[model samples]
Target: MEPSKSEDIYKETKTAKVDDSHEFNEAEVKRLSNYLSTRVIEIVVGVSHKRTFYIHEGLLCYASEKFKIQLRGYFKEAQTGKIPDCQEDPELFAVFADFLYHDGWLRKRKSLYYSCEWVMVSRCYAMGERLGSKVFQRECLWKLQHSITLKKFTIANDALCRILKATTELPERTTGNEDPLRALVLRYAAGQISTLRKDPAFKELLDEHPELGCQILMRVTDDESDCQPSGAPPEKRFEDKVEFL
Candidate 1:
């Protein structure tokens, strides 16, 4: 990424004062300005043909501790001003950048482009997990929760496959009992269990990856009290209260 004149806009320090009551303080403005600036480190991602994203060192260091160590620590990337050969999909990395800059673009895009947005969020979450950025993971999980809770988002078949594969392939984390991304995906599938099961591609995917089937079954089993099969008759719960005076 080439340097642009806009780089000057982000030179403000954290203590820079606000000009107006409605305007943001220097920190917020500087962050946004830095996101827009072309003069900064270039992290080239992807294979065969590479794609570059221009990001400020300060913004990276501030938002991600991994980036802080990699860029400012004794790592070679710190001196080279380049983060090359990132293993994440270029498209997913782009989405990750948007998450960092636009501050979780998923919320805005979720309703407008449901399936695609969910896919991006899932991919971004996987990328975040791989990159060791809890901030990104939390943001992605937050979007997933909102989307699932609202029950309005659609997830693409290929996206689901990607997510499933990503989760299943992820090495077990010593810090937690289960992968959060897997749990989130299972919960999401449980929300629309019938629709997902009915999809031929989904069925084939489950067949190919029995681990996913196990996850779906586990999700259904765990939430069995709350999630009833579509055709099952509704069971009403009656509560009788007896108060002793």
Candidate 2:
């Protein structure tokens, strides 16, 4: 017996949905297969007791154009299938590798403002900048800003100085351009200058990075509203704090 019209309609609809789902699955499988089929390269990080990471070339190149060119072009790294002299910290490189595979930073727990995790994230930001990975840099900045504003986490003077110094060494800084991380630091410092000034380390930071002093001064002069007491809620909205992001 022939099926009823309603039954035929339902069957057609279910078949179409199944076909669409199959197509989506096929696309995902193809993407995964491409990544897996690519050659694996050894990434040697750190100086002493160097930690090595075996990564697919396609995934690494997809995340960083610098690596793409270095590995694909006629560079020594391509011939050896290994990057033997990466100077970045092994722990930080682990974060980068995790991000490449997972699309997010892997942390055991949310870090406090004054924790060493802050410095780690800052270093990761600098490393991301060097690697030409904007996505990694953006995620790091977002994490920093989120902790500062929403968690009401105040950056320690030492951490601030470390971040400032790291950002200052980036290639963009040599070109006299203020990167987003540097700008965010200056903004936060300007907002909490009165409290930061009491710390001797803060004074030393200004001495070491005179340009930071000038920028903070300019920010304070331009927007006195950003000058909030230390540990107080930010005067500006979170969005205003990280306009670059």
Candidate 3:
């Protein structure tokens, strides 16, 4: 059988070592190639001004169970070969497509701009949750955590507010278990509460999402017993408690 375009690209990527950190081993290349198919599905992102992405049906289904179900027999998407009117941000959906095809290319591209990285990852996590792709969600969360702990990337208040609102709106938020993304955000917020509280915009955000305020307060109170001396950074005191879900 002839190798598909995705397989050819993966082979080239492996040969070139496009991203050393996420180089696809031979076995991984073969595994990824297994999902290649000629059929393409058009996904329309955004509401008023839509952006479309043409994705391989097999790979799309393989990456997202939600897409698999939505594109199965008898569904409108199956009949039309299109998922129309998806509400995810077009740029964010582009990131999802990059993950489906090129793996770490998005990370390599976004690394240059540290300011927007957390917001991008957080939005990607929310999208992953919506698409029911645990692997994608895990990858995004790992990136977010890595940026926070190792790179010392601090999320801006406006970005945090956007992330918190996006995460809180997810259907999974009501599932009773503490969401890892939410926990991560709350932990970060708690650590930086002193500075965040001083921001008028953050104050308005708390009013808009009262639960966030409550959660931040609880996180701070709960960690007080384990806090280091006043000289220690708040993030250092709470950092150890973060658990990736």
Candidate 4:
């Protein structure tokens, strides 16, 4: 096959034809090839009848740690202007595939790019909780575009809100940004802070105050308390309350 044809084949195999994400740096092309191998091997084993659904605990940890380093390094370096042209880079999506193809943590193929898209927008959604924020963003976009055409404001809104939040023309961590709630979300998503919900300064937010508490979530699981109804009675628990008896 001609070199051009091979390149076309490679691009097609990745489902990577979004005009926005077609520019490939050589370093990135190599990086994605390796990650795709990881995804393919794990998937083949998953489909094999001979294989039990047990995780390779040791390998899992090793992979997770390695991927974290790669993931963080990729983005951290981006802070220095080395960032990939996110909306147009297939490599950005590969970085996300590293997390979503986890042997167990993920089961949905629909929004394979959801986490990446989410991460790209705000960085406050879950950070690396369920999946890395960037990974979640891409998955959402990919799934939404593939599955339906219902305007998907919720999906687009989610990505829009975060990305808009994450982008600060000039950022100030002390005062929070002018758009503090969005800033808060970025910090949480970037893993700079633990949880947006629990930040002490969150109590200080005057405008979008309620949203601060809503974003608090556990680090390990990324589980959070956002769905509590607005008019629902305040939770009645007696954890550390003082008794007036």
Candidate 5:
């Protein structure tokens, strides 16, 4: 199905907060996105509904982009009694919760791994903007709730993702960013790759795929980088490589 006009928040961000001095720090918004990534979707969903906040993904990201400015606005309004709230307005909090939930979910999904992880990092920093240290405790709760086996499964999947990213040839040489890449590498190091666990065959495959975690320590930096194509040249004909079932 085609996405609804309501689902698109990227455009809204272009003019999201036109009246402000534009002094809000976007980098801070991105940096703080992760702390909220560990939250349960149910919790955020419940909060968003109860609060009547705009909780869809794109709007949430937009809210993050406008976080600092709106945050300042809220605080100022509170002091002046113009707004009776110290917490997020319904719309704002919903955006925050949606951003947090989607980002966290994306960060966890290996298949959806970011070539650059912009979504991942952005989600985290956005959460920090809303809830602060409380986000950290929620993350800890997430860790506590999951089993070690499940966690390991998650890690191994992430490792494969990282390895694929680092080894692939980007359409653009560089996006100058790392989203899922950093998290993926960490997952690999932390034993997320099941193949790395006890299967030597998978280990060998990983050993050969240089494109994994493609953004970090890219081929440009080293003489031995796997960015070089495989020794076997491309086949001139389909029959040369295709095996029939």
Candidate 6:
């Protein structure tokens, strides 16, 4: 027996109900976005140029582990409902705020140059590392990997110095758990070896932080033998390899 025309029409009209749990619903997204943008809490960041940011507690706490614990835990700030003297750079935090709300900073600026943006991103990664925000840290890595392209390597002297300084200072623990940012910087510097070598600031950076030179060498040469300092012990080889690179 054939199915009725009425039954076929009913089946056609009964479209599959979407699983909005994973999908973005415009109305719901708009409502939540508005809430996040309302700015209920004040965060004071920076030293010389102290900047106070008005942000939503929910959005902030959700994105940052430091804020989540500080705002919600049994702390004085929790009772007072005020985040004071955060000691973060306002400029860096601004980029972080963009990430928290929009999941990225790319949408905010259309004509922003990579040199300018990567500096901000490097700072954000530093902030994330300090705050123990794995989410923000991961996002920073993703953004850098996706956005950074091989060009003439036009980062400002100050920014390049800062990046070099930041990468060198990261502490080493047990095996592979080093600061990932350090590796990213090494790769970047390797790609721009020619330009970076000519820069006086970069030379000064190497003089100040000699380990960065090793990192550059390690990244430039793919083979361990090429980077290996003479007579380095077998056991210490991997440790030294990661130490520089």
Q: Which stretches of candidate 5 lie over 4 Å from their true place?
A: 1-7, 21-49, 52-63, 67-176, 180-191, 195-245
| lDDT order of candidates, top first | 2, 3, 6, 1, 5, 4
Candidate 4 TM-score to native: 0.21
Off by over 4 Å in 1: 1-39, 102-104, 107-113, 154-159, 224-245
* Candidate 2 overall lDDT versus native: 0.65
Error of 5 at 172 (Å): 11
TM-score, structure 6 vs. true: 0.66
User: Residue 217 of candidate 2: its Cα lDDT?
Assistant: 74
Error of 4 at 92 (Å): 20
Worst 10 residues of 4 by lDDT: 39-48
Q: Write the per-residue lDDT of candidate 3 for residues 36-133, one digit (tens) a residue.
A: 54378999887667899999886676567667666654456777899876677788888889788655643332332354666777888887876767
**Superior by lDDT: candidate 2 or candidate 4:** 2
Q: Which stretches of candidate 3 lie over 4 Å from their true place?
A: 1-30, 105-113, 172-176, 221-245
Residue-by-residue lDDT tens digits, candidate 6, 8-34? 432343352322232224443334444
Ranking 1 against 2 by lDDT, winner: 2
Give the distance in Å from residue 163's predicted Cα in candidate 4 to where it truly belongs.
16
Encode model 4's per-residue lDDT on 123-240: one tens digit a residue.
4222222222333433333332332222232333334334533343223357543333343333333343334325444334414434433343333244222211123222221132
Which residues of candidate 2, in runs, are more than 4 Å off? 1-33, 106-114, 173-177, 221-245
Error of 4 at 123 (Å): 12
Candidate 1 lDDT over residue span 39-130, tens digit each: 37888777766788888765566555556556655557777888875545788777767656654455442442456666667777766755
